[model samples]
Target: MNDVMWKRSLALFAVALLLVLGGCGQLTNSSSTASTGTTSNRKVQTTGNYSTTGYNSVVTEGHYKTSAARGVAADYANNALDVKGMETGLMQLSQDVFSPNKYTFQEGQYISAANVKNWLGRKSKSNATGLNPEANGSTDPDKRVPEYLGTMVEQDYMTGSGSKLSLGGISIALGMNAVDYYQKEQYGATFQTKVNKDKQLQEGKTMAQEIVDRLRAKNNVGNVPIFVTIYSLAEQDSLVSGSFIAKATATGKTIDKWDSVDQQSGVLPTVNNQKPINSADATAFNNFKTQVQNFFPNLSGVTASVHYLDGALTQMTVNIQTQFYGQTEIMSFTNYVASVANKLLPGNAPIQIIVSSVNTTQALITRNSGEKEFTTNVLQNY
Candidate 1:
């Protein structure tokens, strides 16, 4: 297809993300049709910045362990970016220990939705598996134990090629609440309890060990390496997603050590310099925005999210908003934006530029990591 007529495809398969957020219902295993001692060898294809090894394709699917949790991510997460960031960041962290080159990927099979529901609940007599502290009879939301732990998502990595793949490692991400929103009464105004970084990390450490132990009790899960990551979710009104604060690896029944993760994400063109930002990235985005806005005077706004890992720029997703309706205007603006992105944006990290009108996406520009040339696609309106 020609550049202007090219229709961009979905960027990431998000198998893990779908499974967690879609309320992975009852699922059938591929082993049902495979011969004994071996499963299928098919590796599901995917696009975007990262790739998976192989996966056990599902025959039939059902709800997420807890259907309520799916909405929790949608309603509680700061925005779509935070939801995507939480899922993608978890996989990236898993790749550090369970090399994607060596291990196959699978949606979590051991931790059921039921397990997650219980673990997310308040410690009470009716439900013994609750992980959150029991609620205190305090009028204040702060005095009552905050539902610090939001959701638990698991991804399994396997070894052995051909048909005989076995679980080698498991990675779990615990989404914690940065701000706890609650109501004093049934119809009362919502109250917010800010969870500091120290509190979030401390609660995450304790929960991580307990979750690791719970998984260890499962069949065929003992002795395998398990990686747990703690993600602090952004507040309801925040534009950017919260970041992963810490991670840990568990071998036996216990988690021996924890490591600090220096990863974070922020929106471009800081609001009154409220949040810290990388000056170089900020400058480049500003220049790119200025050029595109200047070229297309009818543009609405241009914004972006810059992601950093270990203090180095890793990725960026820039969004361009326009009011133009004609295909020619969109095509022209898309090409110009792509040119500006090529000249001014950071070359070391992968970057995605999305141009859209009020209702739909108009074009997509993507540059892979370490590559200079950008692939552009302008969507057709039909």
Candidate 2:
């Protein structure tokens, strides 16, 4: 594969990695009924790698879409972290209903790069299916209006095993801008179009319904369960990520009921020295942060993004920034951080600790749910 194709494959894998959970092969009632007019007596089987939860995934090896990966960079927030979070976060949410054990995962096939560009554009005489409001020929930075519907991500789930798998369900994530930042001219003053949480949620829901109507027109979508979620993208400069506000399942061509998602994300060690969300996990992370920073005082900073689902800690990603460049020093620090993480951090949820210098990643340590120790890797310079 070429570089572009390789990167796209990696992006899809990253999204799938987040959906990994612990179990195998039993399809949920909703999932079993999600078939796209395909019938088979074959029981669901694992044709791919197993998740941390021991659940085997039905792998779709050659079904990646190159445009979907580019969409993350072009349509989502400018920050790489935000882009990664939004895509992976959507898959994590989809796993709640379409378990990885039962559904074969694949990158979105229906929406293309041109389709995303058109839908994000303002509604105009030439663009009839635009999801954003018309520009109205405003020149002022504030009056021109920033786009609210930033990006749309689609994840397709399939049921059954082997070559006979069919569409089990589909997930659509709307990445909306909570704060739309724009400049009047090149290298000029930048202004923000702030939309409150309430308004963002409302606007996202409206867009979700519209998107579902458009998808229903597609021949492949059929009557399979379509899960539509609304995510509020964080500011471009934020170290933390945005959260999913609400999600609903569209059984027919339209969504009938919407349910609020109690999902949230926060920066570790408390930003502005504010109180932490879950005291136990917060305390553990703070202690781990202090120990690692103290061990290597040259460390620039240690921060984390903790994710919660239904008020319970589900995942934590820690980023350790340092200035040291020596190979031995990084190796020692990576080991020490791994030990501290294994000792201090909560073990009930998945944790990923990354050690970096300047902008390059130096080492990585990860521990899956229910695991006592973390697996560490120190990257080698070429």
Per model, how many backbone clashes are there?
9, 4
| Each model's lDDT | 0.70, 0.71
lDDT of each residue in 1-382, candidate 1, tens digit only: 2322111111121222233324432122422222223345443221111312123322112212222344444444544556667766887788888885566566677777677778888889988988888888775855767888876667777676435667799998888888888788999899877788899999989989999888888998868999999998877656667788899899888889899999978776666555656887888888888888777878667777788989988778777767787998888878888888899988878787777765677787888677778889998978
In terms of lDDT, the best-performing candidate is 2
Please provide, for model 2 over 90-180, each residue's C-alpha lDDT reduced to its tens digit, 9 standing for 90 to 100: 7778877788767777667777777787887778889988888887566664566567887677777877655477788888888888887
TM-score of each: 0.83, 0.80
Residue 317, candidate 1: Cα error in Å is 0.6
Off by over 4 Å in 2: 1-73, 137-146, 185-188
Off by over 4 Å in 1: 1-80
For candidate 2, the 10 contiguous residues with the lowest summed lDDT are 20-29
